[model samples]
Target: MKILDRYILKSFITTFATVFIILFFIFILQGVWLFIAELAGKDLGVWLVIKFLLFYSPKMIPLVLPLSILLASIMTFGSFAENYEFAAMKSSGISLGRAMRGLTIFIISLSIVAFIFANNVIPKAEYKFVNLRKNIIQRQPAMAIAAGQFNAIGDDFNIKVNKKDGEKGEQLTGVTIHKRKKGEEYATIIKAERGLLTSSESSNLLQLELFDGYYYEELKTKNVRDEKKMPFAKSTFSKQIMNIDLSMLNKNNMDEEQISQTNSMLNISELNYTLDSLQNSYTKETQSIHDNIVKRTTNTLSREISTSERDLSNLEKERDTLKKDKNNLLSLLTTSKKQRILDIATNNTTSNITIIKNSKAAQNERMKNINNHWLAFFEKFVIAYACILMFFIGAPLGAIIRKGGIGLPIVFAVIIFIIFHFINTFGKKLAQENGIPPFLGSWMSSFVLTPLAILLTYRATNDIGMINMDSIIHQITKPFQKLFKLKSNEE
Candidate 1:
């Protein structure tokens, strides 16, 4: 490497390291504050909290890198400007572009690092962080039994302990277990002289060993005729062990549905597969809708034809039967002069025919509505690529911002990212419920941001210039008064 290149690279590395350390400490402090908040009402060890923060650090790198770069750049340039190093370089026949060549190389390298973090490290860390939270929440039951407080482990299990000894690895005095199960309550109150917890891997059990304690177990059995109760008492001979299946206490183990999600721990390939599956789902949904439409249409027409035939048959039967009845009535009428009976028979035939026509019209209208819904379902499949589009938009935006610091940049990024995120989310909902074009709704953020990024980058690069803020502000404000005719109109 050239001497200038080496020099510039060294400055950038030092500045970046300084900025990273500063930002990292800030982030760690924030994490600590959050950890403290989480620990406020709980019995958790400080080391365990620190361990969680350490595990979570890698996930912050992606957010931190960009912000670090921005701050580092500002500091690096500001230092050079302050020392007149830039001026000296310019006077020594080195152009600004030439001096910046090494910085550009450094920026490109950082960009690659950022990309790697975003693509690989961040995803894994995120997965781990989520799992860690689940693990902590699940394991907290074991940790919750502190000195001098009543702690509830699960839905119906309560425990209290008085002094805990570090050397003996046991708790002393005041142990209570209140267990309730399925409309039955059982309380085991113990004033143990000493207590200790022991676990066995083979049996997957956590045993609470209490020494010198009076024990009581209340059992109630439901009966159709009468209820029964049993009481037990124990004075410590040597030891009393209460066996609990620790695996059952492990909430993480029971939540299999949570583990089944692709979003939880998926790699890029898995994400791609999920996206493909969603696409395939939409495809199948569309095909099913089309198939349903065709089947429904054919069934409706067939049913209509059958109904008409049945109606005609009924009408003919009615007419034939009525004619017979009328003939009978006529014979009766001739015999007895009964004109009212003949008039009532004619009215009944007309009413039956009118009912059949109305039923057929209603069936036709329902079939039309079904066909329209099927057509709408087919249209939604085209917009499924919006997820991929939004990702591209977000990734490029991180680069364009140039300020890699997580403070404001991260806030901005998240705000922008979430806005895009929610837009896509709401768009999907709209598409599902209101028959909106899923594609337009889903890709709206990407479409809006792509042009905005391009325009900003163009202005930042060629014309307006990102660093030349004063000049750009002056230019804008100078034209604003003239365009608005404020000063000229006053004159």
Candidate 2:
């Protein structure tokens, strides 16, 4: 029994290591492809690209680990069963249950380690990956600008270039620039036939030198009352220079603590803390909204709470008097007065509807944030449990199929993983949008797959064939067989 356990354990470990390495490589390449647009053509250096891949690798563990476990389990068990080893063990009075005990214990332990890795290591990796990418892009300010598109330079100006050339990508052609200021429009515009971009490594300053350009400035008086026709000045220059401040891009100013406030950068305990805060904030916001609506209604209606019943009775008496004099009042009123009354009612209705819509919109946004926090809280555990669940599915499936090696195992593993992925993604979207309770939405895939795993295990243990193609085909043709027999008897 000890020998058998060792054999199974050894097989699973070797297979798991190989599968994990291959899958990791494949996923990293896929990730690189997805982010190629940002990482490529930037001359970010080989080490930076390597660092990006290293930092990004942890994000793929939750996805890759479970699939590796599933495939390794299938391959291991299938190889044993295919070689008649399971039959020999059964002949010696060892049951399938006993055979699985060693592997099951190993899988349970692995799941715990995987869970801890997800909770601890992944958050830090996510933070580093995000900030490093930002820092890299920020360091190369010129790479951030795109040709043939308006790009803002530190909120001070907008510049566009038709073409970017030269080995250093410093040459710009057919340039257009507009100067911006706070609380004002673009007061100045500049167009150039060509421009050069330069920056100093020691100082956070970007310089743009334009040649053969025209500058246009619009002049306006500060006092609105004394404003005359707006004057404009236009000047053409052979060369001009502009300086842009890049102090904000300084790496010293980067605040990792502030960035880690997002859910992606928090572990389990932090997620729970965030969730609690969000729920508390949501409760306060709802209360505030209710109080605000009540206050607004009270102010707009202009009615005293103490005089409510008296006002109602008095208002009824006035309404009766008004009803009695309705015809007389209509005859005495001017057309403009009637029209003005109608306009006031229409405007009030429209205003009330608009207020309700805005209030609802704000409430929905608050609820969405709360739901997102809850989803993040539940997702950590769901990913951990999915590991154990996948193993159960793969082990039983391998026993039923009785095939070995990578070919059949990979096919089944990929198919099962795709199904799991689809369910998880769909459930996550539903949870984020508040379509379902966060707990239910987050655990939906596990809840669905667990029962399938159980059913497969039961069938495998009971020696029942899940897919008997011959039986299915026979059942379908039975109706046709009966019809032919009836026709032959009649003939």
Candidate 3:
């Protein structure tokens, strides 16, 4: 390696290591804060918290790598600029581009690391993190219950333990259980001198061992139920095993399958399978939406036709009744001259019935309009994959920023990231509810940003100061004004 190359490489390495360490601590602190907040009242150990953070580190690496690269580049170049090292190198006929060659190697290496993290490590970390969260939540009931607090584990169970010993929950001076079954109510109160909780793995049962305790059991009846008290001479085992189905937990163990089959962990063949599966899933969803639209439209049309027929039948019945009333009024009018007023009343009633029928028809038309709108709305996930477009824009922008220091680079990255994130979310909502083209809506930000990123990169690389907005505006305006003046003169 050349002296200049070694010098540049050393600067990059030092800056990258320093930035990574600082960012890693920041991430850890944020993670610890979140964990602490989540487990505020629960009994979680420091080791468990540390393990959680370690498991989460792989996912953070992808985000951290890009920023680290940016900061390293900026600091290294800035330091060279500050120390006149760049000037000295330039005096020796070494161009700026040549000095940057070693840094480019570092950036390429970081990019590879980023790819590895994104493709392999991040996905596994996500899977593990999800499983870890589930495990924690499943075991939370035991961990959350304090010695004197009434703990409600489920809809029908509330328990309070006065004292808890190591591994074994014991010294239960007062234990109260209020349970409500589907169609019955029961209450059990025990004043035990000592108690122990034991778990059996073979049967998956948790047993509560109570010693020298008096048990009062009450069952609700049609009349006021009486409490039955029983005295135990020695240790009485009142074991109520929680029938927690572990099927879901067992299913969660299928992370291995995801790890084995997913593109993140798999080679070319497995990635193909994963992509095929995703495509198939998306296709199936589209097909399902199509089927649902067809079925719903058919059902809606059938209902509208049925409702119209019912309305027609009701109108016909009303017409018949009005005709009968009219005939009765004519007969009355012929018999007595005062009955002519009754004929007018019968006609008015028929008119009102006709108006009601028209109103109902209008309502049916409105319902059909609503159903059509909803059908159009549900068909928009076709564009959900368009979010990948933003990645192309974001990645290159990072490269163009040149000053890879965390400060400005991080702020810019975050702004871009947030904008992209919001665009995706907004597009999804619009597509789902408003019947927007999911593809167009979801890819809108990407479409806009890609050209912008390219333009900016080109300008930045050519040393055409990216911040020269005023000059660009003046150039554009001046050309247009000159063209307009020339046309006026020609006229």
The CA lDDT of each predicted structure is 0.53, 0.80, 0.52
Which residue ranges in model 3 land beyond 4 Å of their true spot?
37-50, 136-141, 144-196, 209-491
lDDT of 2 by residue, 1-491 (tens): 59989988898899989999999899999999998866765556788788889889998998999999899888988888789888898899887778888988998888888888888888888888888777665666777667777876676778888988887778999999988787885479999999999986677889999999898887777876554454667899999988888877654432342344567778888888887887888788778877876676566444322333345766566676678777554433456655755675566568767877887888888788877777767767877898899989998888777878988778889999999989988998888888998888889889889998999888877667587534665899999999999999999
Residue 357 lDDT in candidate 1: 60
Steric clash pairs (candidate 3) = 70-404, 71-404, 71-405
lDDT of 2 at 213: 87
Error of 2 at 32 (Å): 1.1
Ten contiguous residues with the weakest lDDT in model 1: 378-387
Q: Give candidate 2 regions above 4 Å deviation.
A: 146-152, 156-194, 214-235, 251-260, 303-349, 468-491
Model 3 TM-score on a 0 to 1 scale = 0.53
Writing each residue's lDDT as its tens digit, candidate 3 over 1-491 gives 89879877887688778978888888777777876645554557777666678777765664455445544555556456546665687689886657666666655555555554455555566567765655664443455455777765444556677766664333355665554545664555545556555433343333456565565555444543232232222234544333433333333332233222222334333454554655565456556655765565466434433323235665566676667676542322233333433454465457546755765465444433333333222212212222223223333343344344456455665666567557656765665453565455555555666676567545534445454434655787998899999999999
Worst 10 residues of 3 by lDDT: 378-387
In candidate 1, how many Å is residue 410 off?
14
Give the clash total for candidate 3: 3
Best by lDDT: 2
The number of the candidate with the highest TM-score is: 2
RMSD of each: 13.3, 7.9, 14.7
Model 1, span 1-491: residue lDDT tens: 78877886787678778868978989877777876645554555677666578667875664455555545554454455446665687678775456556766556555555555545665566566666656654554455565567766555566777666654334546666655555665565555677786654344466788776765565445663333333444444357787665575554541222434334244445555665665566557556655765565466444433323235665665666667577542332232223443443455446545644664465444433332333223222212222223223332333233333334344654565566556656665665443565445545555666665555435433324344434655787987867779767877
